[model samples]
Target: MTKKVLAAVKTDVETIEIREFDYPTVKPESGILRIEASGVGGSDPELYRKAGHVPVIMGHENVGTIEEVGEVAAKRWGVKSGDRVALHEYLPCWNCEWCMKGDFRLCMEVDFFNVKDRLNTDRFGMSTANKPPHLWGGYAQYMHLPLNTVMHKIPQDMPATHATLAVPFGNGVQWACLDGGAGPGKTVLVWGPGQQGLGCVLAAKAAGSYTVILAGMTRDQSRLDLSLRLGADYAINVETQDLEAEVMRITKGRGVDVVVDTTGDPKGEIVKQSIALAAKGAYLSLNGLEQQVPIGEIKKRYLTVRAPRGRSYAAVELALRYIGSGRYPIDQVCSHTFGLAQVHDAILATAGRGVQGAIHVCVEPWK
Candidate 1:
């Protein structure tokens, strides 16, 4: 009997349904992966709540072993059967200028959000299971790996949960250091103490920023404390104390040299606050959606404003190496894990609506 694959499909607003699909054929220049762990990303909560989209398998941060790979595909990826690897979501057309420059983030082929009929796209995690070869997401027993899929080799003995964190760390390094210009002698301020914000803390510190301050609400004291343990120099409660006053005090009234907000709020309050706390030549990178902030303040302050998302190839490599080096107690960050059957609970916890204090959550398929 042909085997069937199991996946947790996001069927509606804040809903998940376990479904089955036929195992896909392994054509030349393609492969199949036996997924071990899939980290629930910061974006997962928002995506889970979004409506009017096709039922796509929804976990994007995937780490698995190569169950099978076509001859050409194995050769091209320098990976063989049974090898552990981390799968990147990008399916870039290699011939494009962006791909040639190794900036797959800018490749138009994988820009699912802007493209028309985006629900019918091929980008992993967002692809609909409406068609054949439906194993496009990581919340499944197996996944289909196309030829253009970007992958990184993971060491044999690394824990699947720990290895799965490379994606968020990649985003951290990209947003904090590469784009936000955090480096030696700079005082950096990050808004939020969640996994992504803590990631920015580690990245900023690793980049040699002189000071790293993490801000969260009064209710996030636990997470704020975790940020300090994870390498943040200071943790401030924006709700209990004045955010701008506390930031200025921490920076000795010089304002922050680099600022990053991971809260993903649609309102402009955080963005405006970031502007108010920036140094004369500071850099600001916010993950929030479009907000009406005063552009004049940015111009007056000579602050460089950037909105960064996704990870770079180099950043991914650096993050994996960092995780493997055993430099930080990364296991503490993997605060929650659930079996495939409990994907809904995991999402709820990560969304902060169910379980209290879920730092980083993962779905272990065989758990």
Candidate 2:
């Protein structure tokens, strides 16, 4: 029997068509899972807006329960059908040079949400690494996980909806804790107080940063409040207040040791402010390019501007472990929950205002 699923089609400029398609009827592979809740990403805003491209599956962050599994995969991953798991975006070529060094994220044949295959066109742009064609992305009713990729079993006690936030939160931990060297006695500035920005605040605090100064807009008052609750030492309203002055005041003129730019606004003023707030040797980690940087300051200050590479599955797993440990509250990042049908509205909500404290956007898998 053919199952039914939703497909994100570009209907027009700044619009998406959520039409249903026949789902994959193939059986599950050994040790693999059929995911449930897949998380949406901030990077996908352009895709939704049809700015660059239009009409793709349009989901990356996700978690789900194992619906069925092949015998071999079940034994190998210690995951059986019905086991809850969070999906990693990358499906690495395990034997590749990078994967050999345990850098799976750098694999040349990596598939981000199984969108494309770098090797053969024989599959009609579908990835045939280790899973069947039916299992591809989580935007639909089913997604496939190759045996070699990093798919961890989340704690049974944690809801998959909450677990869906892991990818974004893991991004926070990876960018702030592991990449930016955020930890004890260090100060970090988190620019853009959206879900990802607030996540940076929480991750830096959890990583033991001396202080986390948040620079956001006056409209982000709710996010600022949430940041304070999540452990921000200071939250600066960049809209009304002077950003440079606030950063200087918070750091006592020395500037923060690190700055995390989760907002991809290239021309957005917050990015420039973030650059100015970085100390000479400070690590400025831009998760993605939102806006262009001023070359003058970059040349003069000797700033180490870098973009975050793929996260350590192990590091992300550790972040998930931290979430399970009850020490740092992961649920604090989620702001709301909605069924799969409400996806368009969810996207609109994210575009409207900041999902302060990580709004839990839930997608109930078809039972």
Candidate 3:
């Protein structure tokens, strides 16, 4: 085994430096993972541009193989050498009530927003690399998996590239199926054709929604087409067509039963549009962090508004099953791949800046 590991460290706003670190000694309660693929989400650009924690290794969605596992960790995690797995970013204290209830995503210990100290909240890709072990994130050749790290075994037949879809697919299952209440006999409107929005389209279709409509700008023509191929009933180019009118025309003025906005629209324009397009007593699942919503409009419409956080244990399990089923062309969603040295361009690709027609970008640390 190599004595050192290589990683892409974000030293400042919009800056990435490839650095090397000594391989961490394996502890009886911990393990080391050889990263295969690290997914780049829409949020990655913001994390790169915003100066929060300096010199952080930022790649949260990670899939890798177990290179070294301590005896205790092996028994507790039920894994051994050479086993492929998808790692969850959250590192919650197992003793917390949220962890006990299997909602570890809500645990305050790993809640970076609520917690002040960077060391206390150990979120993969967000935590500072200044701490010991030095390889906390997936934009590296290896990642240090602590005792409390959450992971799921990947089926031997599934390719690592396909397994990389777990996180986004899980979010789709969480926001669309679980939070938006998309199912049989329901009409769903997903207000973004990004990777997350496309995931929602798949989840809604799998859940047997009567109609799944995906909305996007003209720049997302390729993504919208892909969404249709994945079972979305309509893909509206909101920039060209009248969004509300087109939606009403499709549903015969009844409006959609569920509206899921993953646009992350800064001005909350899409959110307001989602509220207006929703039917009476409809469910609205939003993933945007900062958005101004009209409370009076929500109350008058009797809408059930839900802000979906990260995926739960059940959601990830379901997403894995869906990915393993060969059901939809989920693998097609991962549109681009970059080597560790191209980490800057990789994040830019996800933001639709550098790469043309890029959707879901993956960073191959070893490449």
State each model's CA lDDT, in order: 0.87, 0.66, 0.88
lDDT (tens digit, per residue) of candidate 2 on 244-330: 887788778999888887776556665666677788778888654456767788878877778766476876787677667676555
Residue 258 lDDT (model 2): 88
Give per-residue CA lDDT, model 3, range 1-367, as digits (tens). Answer: 7598999999988999999999999999999999999999767898899866678899989999999999999999999999999988999898989999989999998887798776447789888898889899999999999999999999877877677778888888999998778999999999888887888898899999999999998999999999998879999998899989999999999899998888776666878888889999999986577786789999999999888688887888888888788877766777788999999999998898978999889999988
- Candidate structures ordered by lDDT, highest first: 3, 1, 2
Badly placed stretches (over 4 Å) of model 2 are 2-35, 51-55, 111-135, 268-271, 287-302, 328-332, 353-360
Provide the TM-score for each candidate, comma-separated: 0.97, 0.83, 0.96
Candidate 3: residue 44 lDDT (0-100): 86
Global Cα lDDT for candidate 3: 0.88
Under the 3 Å rule for N, CA and C atoms, how many clashes does model 3 have? 0
Supply candidate 1's per-residue lDDT for 197. 89
The clash number for model 1 is 0
Error of 3 at 249 (Å): 1.2
